[model samples]
Target: KLLSVGALTLDTILRVETLPVHQGKFIASDGLQIASGMATSAACAAHRLGAEVSLWASAGDDAVADQL
Candidate 1:
């Protein structure tokens, strides 16, 4: 088993053709929402490698936390 305890965050990853270099807005071709943060990601990786993993982290009592 693998146990991890630390921060858990929601990652908003974007894929774009190029990053903006000026003071202007840009749009992404694609985007992804993923469960992230050090311990959280490690636990996921361990689970993928066939380990029984557990992650201990705190989340807020809001819609965002609900998504996590």
Candidate 2:
């Protein structure tokens, strides 16, 4: 078994043809959300390799936290 301790965050990935320069307004071609963080990612990788993994992280009492 593996234990990981650190921040657990929701990684928002975006695919864009061109990065916004002015930054007034921009749009992404695609986007995705995934569980991410130093320890969290490590834990997931270990789990995929057939190891039992546990992640110890904290979240706030909000919608984003609920998602985590």
Which candidate number would show the highest TM-score if scored against the true structure? 1
Q: Across residues 38-61, which tens digit of lDDT does each residue of candidate 2 receive? A: 999999999999999989999778
Which pairs in model 1 have colliding backbones? none
For model 2, the superposed segments whose C-alpha errors exceed 4 Å read 21-24
Candidate 1: tens digits of C-alpha lDDT, residues 1-68: 87899998999999979877887777889999998999998998899999999889998899889999
lDDT of each: 0.91, 0.89
* TM-score of each model, in listed order: 0.87, 0.85
Candidate 2 lDDT score at position 41: 91
Count clashes in each candidate, considering only residues at least 3 apart in sequence or on different chains: 0, 0
Predicted candidate 1, C-alpha RMSD: 1.2
| Highest lDDT model number | 1
